[model samples]
Target: MKRNIKRIIFVVAAVAVWVGAFFMTQRLLEPKYMDDLIEGALTAEYYDETTKHDVIFIGDCEVYENFSPVTLWENYGITSYIRGNAQQLIWQSYYLLEDTLRYEKPEFVVFNVLSMKYGEPQSEEYNRLTLDGMELSPVKIKAVEASMTEDEELITYIFPILRYHSRWNQLKSEDFEYFFKKDKISHNGFIMRADVRPATTFPEPEPLADYTLPATCWEYLDKMAALCKENDIELILIKAPSLYPVWYDQWDEQIVEYAQKNGLAYINLLDKCDEIGIDFYSPETADTYDRGLHLNLSGAEKLSNYFGGWLCSNYQITDHRNDPDISAVYSEKSADYYAMKEDQLRELSEFGELKSY
Candidate 1:
């Protein structure tokens, strides 16, 4: 009996040490992990807390790629942000809106309808969670506690263990300090892009005969639409800019139906491109040439600026023009816009506008 008690005591001490170390590693490494990956893991917690925008754009990856919050702040005086991800389908958008409404009372929240049409709820890999979602910053904790549903609040957004399957790999490393080191986060809180170069190209996705909505999506969407109505926030639904041929059949019609039914403003830029003469087809316009699933920076500028100008017409927001500090942050970002403009201006000046123009 005495020998058994000693063995039990030793086991208890070992367990105590292990628990202490795991928490120690997690606490020490948390800042760096947030700097590196939180933007993609947690939403509703991190992004919206630091976000001080008059307008916040939420959707799927289409929102991030196509909207430059800097440009929105610079040109129109309206502060905006893209809280988008790769697989933020319609249902997730509903939850996100519910989450955002807890703290941020932006003048307008833009929703991209692409994922509303094609994204899958079970396909979490494709689900886009932003640094905004995972931030454990003091504000992040409050945002999660105040805004999110008990399930998302407890599982995915705050703790993040339920969302990222790969986190265990970090735990297994030998030198595996749980801490990540990052040089910076932006003044306005979007993680600054470390590299000026373009991200890897994705191949054009194959066309599907019939694009269908996931059954789980309708409930969240219904909730989101109702939430906007109740709060009196103008919910603008846009069929985000994508290549025409790639957009396939009745895409606009389906989104249009949703928009009209919800009394949301819908912008179909594909159809609007006729008035603007920005061709989504033609190799010259599509610099990446990967068959139109994604656009190079040049294409993104045309689309973003066009949509930016269009969005400004509806909302009244703060002008960031006089903010020299904000200008400093954007100077490096202007490279993408400058490069794109050079091509467009040179093309226009040399040929006096192409067959498209």
Candidate 2:
């Protein structure tokens, strides 16, 4: 009996050490989005949210960079979160919504329609930025299967170390600093930029040979709509007021027709830019940092304020600002939001750009 016990203990100890070393290696090799490429960190940050969100926005950078949840909370008492990624494909957005539902179902789901233009996976780098941060689940598996490019491998996502193990020599300070955990880099999913660079000129949009959004894109959208309906959640589609990658008339017509067919509300904010008080062309009042591609902190707040009013008027979203528990959560979030904004401004004033983000 003693001999048998000793053998079993030795095997267990060996397995434990091997398992620990494998995970440690995985952690050390994986790219830490802490210093730069921070957008990769956004998806994982949602899991750390303490209070439940009433509205969830999912799409590409347009949804994340153009809208501010903290502004919505302060102005209209609406609590929200954005589950956005860089160049998020429609299927990925749908899967992300599904993944979000696994955690908490919100009263409303807002999707940006810019991704409708993409029918297939764009790039493996973007796929990793969006998927690697997601917690392992059936939804993530499906997202990976749908998002992987021709050259990409599925096992690489499951075991990122397989893809990044060679990064041993390139590993930086952050690789170890954030080895155990990551810092919250966004303000309720909003990446703040206080610097301003006004829109000057944009390259003429070369007309696409085909105006019709792909069948695959529409199919995933149908799935998104059906899932929202089954969960009794309202879905709102919007074309954010981005000046480039022009929103063609033919494309807008198709979305309008679809919205009518499904009894959904699709607001083209590009049409309401003037009404929303956005001065994209003026340097003194410009809201975008990279010309008109994405909004700065000032622009996002303006957009959120207008959109929040429209939402409250059209829907019965409960304002949790007065709710003691939720209020406490927002209070802490608001403090962080302003502090970051101040820091970004200080950085911009002194250094001509932000360094901490």
TM-scores of the candidates are 0.63, 0.99
Candidate 2 Cα errors over 4 Å, as ranges = none
Task: For residues 1-357, write the lDDT of model 2, one tens digit per residue.
Answer: 999999999999999999999989998999889898999998899999987899999999998999999999998899999999999999999999999999898999999999999998999889999999999998999999999999989889999989998999999999989988888999889888888989998888887889999999999999999999999999999999888778898999999999999989999999989888888988677999889999888999999998999999999888787899998999999999999998888998899887776
Cα deviation in Å at residue 88, candidate 1? 1.5
Task: lDDT for model 2, please.
Answer: 0.92
Among all candidates shown, the one with the greatest TM-score: 2
Which residue pairs in candidate 2 have backbone atoms (N, alpha carbon, C) closer than 3 angstroms, thus clashing? Answer: none
Prediction RMSDs, each to the true structure: 9.1, 0.9
Best candidate according to lDDT:
2
Worst 10 residues of 2 by lDDT: 276-285
